[model samples]
Target: MKRSGNPSARDTKEGLVGWVEAKRKPIGTRPLRIKNTSRRRRDMINRKSSLGVALAIYLAFCALPGIAAEPDVNSLPKERQQQWDKIKSGMEQEYNVCIEHCGGKSECEQKCRQAHESRLQREFLKLQTAEAVPAANDTDLVHWRKTSGTGEQE
Candidate 1:
């Protein structure tokens, strides 16, 4: 029985069956369930936990010991602290004298140079004794004398 605008009965049924078959095929088809919310939440939790663990380990290894072992110089024994201050003051005076000698008039330069050299020699001897080391070697002494502008040899 062929209809006017529609095809014959067998043709119409066959066309509908083809359309259903195409829909069943997987070509360009999406999944029934789209988003996996649980997996995404698990991944977020794992990332946060790993970051927290790494931060804790870093602080423990890199920061804790440095904070614990630092000594406050102000809390040193009184005698040691006083000796440190004396050494600091002497160093300051020696530096000023050296600067004046290296950049001043001839008479003032000579006086300052002598004072600076004497103080430096004293300090060198003190350090050598404290460290149980020999005084400056011949080459070192020669270099120092030349640098101090008190070289006796050419």
Candidate 2:
């Protein structure tokens, strides 16, 4: 029977059959039941267990020691500590100068920092070499000079 107003509102036999078909599950398919509260509890437990496992792994890795640890300045030998302090101080001074020169720009400061670090590394290497080599005598220099064909004699 068709009502006069909206076509969708009309209750025809075809519409009745369509509604019945929509409600019916396909052949061989079971109707979906509301998920059990126990199933929801299990899912929550799984999520919690996974989170715990992840946290355990993180802690285990972190506790393994010296990960991303920077060398302590105070632990360095006195001479090395002095050198480090000098370099660090020089970096700050250069950084300030560079900032002033470039109107406080980050790029200039970064360049200044890199230069300072490079100088520090070079000086550190020099110190290491000096530490490794015992004081050179005049005789060694004369011997080397003679062997190398240098005309100058000590």
Candidate 3:
């Protein structure tokens, strides 16, 4: 039977059957009943382990005064340094083109920098959405200078 005065309620036997079918789960697909007991004991053990690790690290640092508290970015692996150099090169090339277009004007340079940064970020956003990066053959100047088909982006 349908709920009283409910226009959207299932009324017919077919509708009732359909609702029941939708709600029903597959046979033999029972949920697991893990023995998730001793939670307090587990939490206490984890806290004790963490405190022990912290104490060990503190003692090690106390024993060695020359050791830095934080890792230095300059000490990154050679492979990582090469990757960073590549990224820096790409950005530097883009900025150089902007600088060229600016023609030594501070105001124009500022505007170009803003436009370059915006375009770079927009390209990154496109990549984040699984789109391919623009062709490597195209120079930053050529790519950046291309006019959009539409008067403006959405």
Candidate 4:
């Protein structure tokens, strides 16, 4: 009878030792399965990198408003410009009053300036809320104006 060179045939003849040696791969050899898995891993990494780049771009766009320069009032419509002018003039008036009232006292001037800034903020809020809610009753606006030292409700 002719003998076959197959490892299994040798295993049956040599017992456990031959079967273990037959199952072992030679040194410096890799399994064929690694090639497919490595290719899949590379593709996954590329997809993740592309998604990271897109996320970075989206975040940059979202942050643009905070990084951009202040708006140009000169470019505003006439009515808006007038509102800005009114606010500015009011601020100037407050500054003049503070200067006159506080005289050379820096502490008093600082307090007066703080009060003026608070009033300015309230005025801005009033204007914004009033314009944003056109249907807002006079009473709502009067509350904001009352804090501004303007007793007039209309």
Candidate 5:
């Protein structure tokens, strides 16, 4: 048989040894794949940490004071506050009387409401006249009252 030029024998042996070594190593030994026990431990730790963070966030939101602030009525001007209080008291009294009357006879509720509205309108007109008059002097008060009366008639 005819023979070709002799190939290097040492190079062939080294290549075979490297291939064998590569095949012998376990595929699971790669960095991406954990051992069975280590994988279980990692999963447990992840679950616990996620639950802890969720609970912490929930508690932080609950502890905030968004719902605890009270409105400060005293911040309003004194005269305006007094006027609001008077109006509120009168409305409350009228509401109670209406409720009592309506409970006894529902048909009377409309008449009661009309009367209450007229009283409130009169009170508002008086307050407006008082505010319009510059001073307590008779001339100014008389003029304002006359003007207010004519305006209401129109």
Candidate 6:
């Protein structure tokens, strides 16, 4: 009878030495029945990378409004533009008041700025709703205020 090269080929005992040899599988090698770990690790990495990319895209889109560039009032419709212009001018008035009233008081200036910004935000939202445009969230008024010469923080 020919002895098979694979000692662990059979579960049943061929002999004591054969049984021991069968139990002693080559180092760094898996049984034929076992799933390949390397392949599973590769698949796991692929899944993780895909999920990371998806999350990045989601965050980027969600932050669009907060990180938006200064809005162009002209981009809005005629009525909406006029409304935004009115709101902006009003905020400008408040800004002048903030600077003048606060004078050199950092605390007072900060409070005034906060109040003015809140009012501006409220009016901006009101204008958008009143306009009823499809793309109503069209302006980043806060960003505009910071960038525009009007009411910009010192």
Per-prediction TM-score to the true structure, in the order listed: 0.25, 0.33, 0.27, 0.35, 0.31, 0.38
C-alpha lDDT of residue 58 in model 2: 94
TM-score of 5: 0.31
Candidate 1 Cα deviation (angstroms), residue 131: 35
What ranges in model 6 sit over 4 Å off? 1-75, 131-154
Best by lDDT: 6
* Candidate 3 lDDT, 32-95, residue by residue in tens: 2235647676667667877998999999989665332222336555655565456546877989
Q: lDDT of all the models against the reference?
A: 0.57, 0.62, 0.58, 0.65, 0.59, 0.66
Selected candidate, larger TM-score, 1 vs 4:
4
Ranking by lDDT: 6, 4, 2, 5, 3, 1
Residue-level lDDT tens digits of model 1 in 1-154: 4545545333454454222324464643532333556866766776787799899998789965654342344744565456656775787787686676577677776677566555645654454344221246655665566666676543
Query: Model 4 segments beyond 4 Å from truth?
Result: 1-78, 132-154
Best-fitting candidate, scored by TM-score: 6
lDDT (10s digit) by residue, model 2, range 91-141: 668767776887767787778766665666665556555432123565567
User: Clashing pairs in model 3?
Assistant: none
How are the candidates ranked when ordered by TM-score, highest leading?
6, 4, 2, 5, 3, 1
Please provide, for model 6 over 34-61, each residue's C-alpha lDDT reduced to its tens digit, 9 standing for 90 to 100. 3556867767776787799899999999
Please report how far candidate 4 places residue 34 from its true position, in Å.
Answer: 65
Better of 4 and 5 by lDDT: 4
For model 1, name the residue pairs that clash: none
Q: On a 0 to 100 scale, what is the lDDT of residue 65 in model 5?
A: 49
lDDT of 2 at 148: 61
Q: Pick the winner on TM-score between candidates 3 and 6.
A: 6
| Alpha carbon deviation, residue 37, candidate 6 (Å) | 38
* Backbone clashes, each candidate: 0, 0, 0, 0, 0, 0
Provide C-alpha RMSD values for all models, in order: 21.2, 12.2, 20.5, 17.3, 20.9, 18.3
2 or 5, which is superior by lDDT?
Answer: 2
Clashing pairs in 6: none
